[model samples]
Target: MKAGFSAFERYKMKGRFKWIAAAAAVILCVGLLFACKKDKGKEQEDISESTEAQAQAQASGEEGESEPARAEEEDPNKLEDGMMRSYLSGLPVDEKIGNRRPVAIMLNNLEAAQPMSGISKADVVYEYVVEGGITRLMGLFENYDDLDKIGSVRSCREYFVYTALEFDAIYMHFGQAAYAVDLLAQDYVDNLNGLGEAGDTCFYRTTDRQAPHNVYTSASGIEAGIKKLGYREDHYDGYKGKFKFCDLNEVVTNEGGGSAKHIEPDYKINKPWFDYNEKTGKYDRYQYGAPQIDELTGEQLSYDNIILQYNKWAQLDQKDYLAFDCHSGGIIQYCTKGMFTIGTWRRDVDSAKDGNVDMAPVRYYDMDGNEIEINNGKTFVCVIQDSALEDIVLE
Candidate 1:
């Protein structure tokens, strides 16, 4: 019976060993499958990482190549379609018009010269007090090809010639003040005087007005005079423009500025004022209690920017012909977008390499000493006596 029990135990042990062997074989097969999957997954992950690295490298190379081109496209100074910005208005214009020098025509602002012809085409207008508390207008026209009549043209003041020099403009006048004769005779001063040899070629007298107020100029006459005089029609090779302008789509709100809904320069004569028009986003001009309109278009004169530049001034002689210190620094009131900024203006005459004061631009700066950026449109600049600061009003 002991021998029989031993045999059964041996058989049971053998069966148990067979079952354990089968279990071992199953475990080894499962381990092998898991190892194969892990290796396959690692290989796939390595490929993915390599591809990602290559893609990143390609992207970086592309970004490096396109960055400058993209920046150039975004540049505000860059224009499209062979166009250039107007130095006078800061608006886009033809390359030819933008490159040419502007014509600065003197306009009579007296009551008799009401509804001045072709004055609306002026990109920039300057008003300065002359003798007898009266102000004269100097209109700087950049694109005047279509203008048939400009100004009831008036006499030039020495100060006006200096102002025209700031823009490198070709000065045009029917006559000049006696004090201006010597200055106008200077070789650097290229002016078309109606009383000089170019008078018949550059200007004509209208039948409707008296002698002094009757002189007028046209685009054809101006072109004729320019050709006859052989004046340089193009701007200087490296001429830097005055008045930095905002981009085409940009709008300067004059941040931290004062209200400028109504501006009154408080001139004793003419009594010129500006009222902000919300609809047109411009300041409509009024003088002598009436809208200042252009005779050619019959449209009321308006401006996008108005500058009241207060300068130290003196009477030259008994005639009251004034001399404004254009080189010296002065207080400035710059108004735009129904807002006004108190600033300062200075022309660095001493810094001019050529010793030409007219070539120096009168730069405007804010209280913080940052150059003020004006809007892109027609501008009206009023040269007021510094003592008359109290007389000026802005609301």
Candidate 2:
């Protein structure tokens, strides 16, 4: 019985060993398959990383690639908005900037003349506070199509400082010059030589079209330039040069839309001085009429008379007087002394005091771009042209 039990135990032991060996082999095969799968996944991940790195390096212009563009930023306007957009991180232009980003709407619009195409003599006139010289002379003609080939003003756009309000820039050309010229103290013509013409290229940036072009030379040339180059008014139906000029006497709507009092100019600039002494002083203020360089010139005019004549006109017409000096371009032509001086004489006071004029004469200059721009000695004419603003007229 004992021998039979020993045989059964040995057979059971062999069977158990065989089963354990088979299980071990299966475990080994599973481990090898998992290892191969991990190795293949690692290889694929490396290839994907390499491709991504190569693409980044190309965009950065590295690895013998062409150099990226140097930053050449220029301010379109000194306005706060312009500066913010160009320099700030989150600006529209900055967000859309390269890696070859799409062009902006404004940039695209600027490329097209659509913003400027439609203008009329009555609708818009982009005025410039310009100095005389070839710029003013050439500007008088406005758009020169023949000169456009030579970089006429058309190559450049304009920003306008409407009356007292600055930074409200509009894209104006051609008839725009007319508005600027009319406000520019008329003495701009007198200062042409002071602007200093160089060989052949135009240099005045504030006034000239762009640069390096001298297509027109005189007032007639300026007029021709306007016609030949197709003025903004010519392109658009509603526009006329009239929008450039404003009559101080006329009441107009507030475009920017604000209080009618503050926004609507009271011609207070013209009468700035009138308010000063009218309240506290005598009922009649003193202003000298027709300030002349010569006390005995009868008409009270300078040796060259235009400046003094202008001052005299100011006294009579607007009660605003200016002095003339040799320094003032237009008034200098009429200087009696090397420097002529003028004062305000209240005519109303003078009449009451038996020709005794009350004066508040000052030394003024044109550098400030005031109504009286010349040295306090120079005067300006208050010549107001009362013509109908262009009412949608065309040739």
Candidate 3:
């Protein structure tokens, strides 16, 4: 009986120990679950706080942290206002205007045609000797919508036509020299001649000036002539610009360059010169002992860049029609920001055989063989005879 009571007591004690172990195990599991839930809640709180801070930062316009992502997707060459860079001026312009082909109009630079109308608006201007020690002007206008009177239109020279080709411009003139007739009649030359069938529609004589110097073309007349001729109004599909320009916001000082505060291209006639204006950062033009003012605007003509392109030239015939070596390489002097630099200008002569010569731009390179950069504005190019290079004075 004593041994049976001892076994029963041992069994009861074992059952109590088992119950206590199971209760402790359940309490430990509950505590672990609560701790995991608290940890998950803290993680969610951290995420919520981070998002809220970002939103606040954005609202306060302190979004510098996110700028890198936005900048990565933005185009460095394009302006924020959806304006396109102009091929001629390297300035912001409407896309339609920027993409259209520029017009190269020949202007009479005789003393009788002083104060030329609409000349100040030209994106680029070329001055070269025509004949009899006289100089003629070829103004390239990229945007001429508001120009009422563009020129006292003059005849075209073969060399002027080639210069116009460099810009892929629609060559415009009242007439052409005999030497230019064969070249102008070619299919590649898209010119609006005042002496041709489009004459009545594209040009008119102003009573304010005399016969040869009175012939003028307006913006409407140019548009009408282009529409009547059915010429392509836009630039070529793969037309990269002729010039490489600096950014609009940037200014190139031409550091350590030669002084170009005053430029005098001493032609036998007209005697054109330029004075650098510190206030406007442009070269103010002067010719025939006075400012080269625009008749319509009453404003003097100015340019951001001045290029002296020296080329081998010759008189073609007894009539003295001039021919310049446009296809050949030549010495070039580029001036801007009151300073000047020497460079070389070249064009691929082989391109002429491929019928794509006009599409090839005359490239400019420094002595180091690197392409030179031009400022963003109107340019004045003086096509001087290489023999007369010493006549040019840059003070």
> lDDT per residue, candidate 2, 1-395, as tens digits?
01111211333445531211222232123222110000112233445777678767777866444735548855432234322221101122221121111100000011111112111101111111122100110111122222212112332211121111111111212222222333222211111111222212221222333232322232233333334433322212211111111122221121221111111011111111111112321111111221212111223211111122111100111222111111112211111112222222111221211221211112222222222222111112221111111110101
How high is each candidate's TM-score? 0.81, 0.15, 0.80
Error of 3 at 317 (Å): 2.3
Candidate with the larger lDDT of 2 and 3: 3
Return the TM-score for candidate 2, rounded to 2 decimals. 0.15
lDDT of 2 at 107: 9
**Ten contiguous residues minimizing lDDT sum, candidate 1:** 32-41
Q: Which one wins on lDDT?
A: 1
lDDT tens string, model 3, 164-265? 888878999988876677678777778999999799999999898788889999999999999999888998776777888876656666665678899998
In model 3, the runs with Cα more than 4 Å from the true position are 1-76, 80-82, 348-355
As a whole number from 0 to 100, the lDDT of residue 164 in candidate 3 is 86
Number of colliding residue pairs in each model: 0, 39, 0
Can you write out model 1's per-residue Cα lDDT over 1-395, one digit (the tens) per residue? 01111211333445531221222232123222210000112233445776677667677774445434323446756788879989998999998999999999999999988879999999999999999999999999988999888889989888898788888889999887876776787766789999898999999988898877888999999999989898999888767678888878676767556788999997889999999999999999999999999998989999999999987666655777677766657778888878887777998564342667656778887766777888899999999877777667888
Local distance difference test values of all predictions, in order: 0.80, 0.20, 0.79
Sorted on lDDT, highest at the top, how do the candidates line up?
Answer: 1, 3, 2
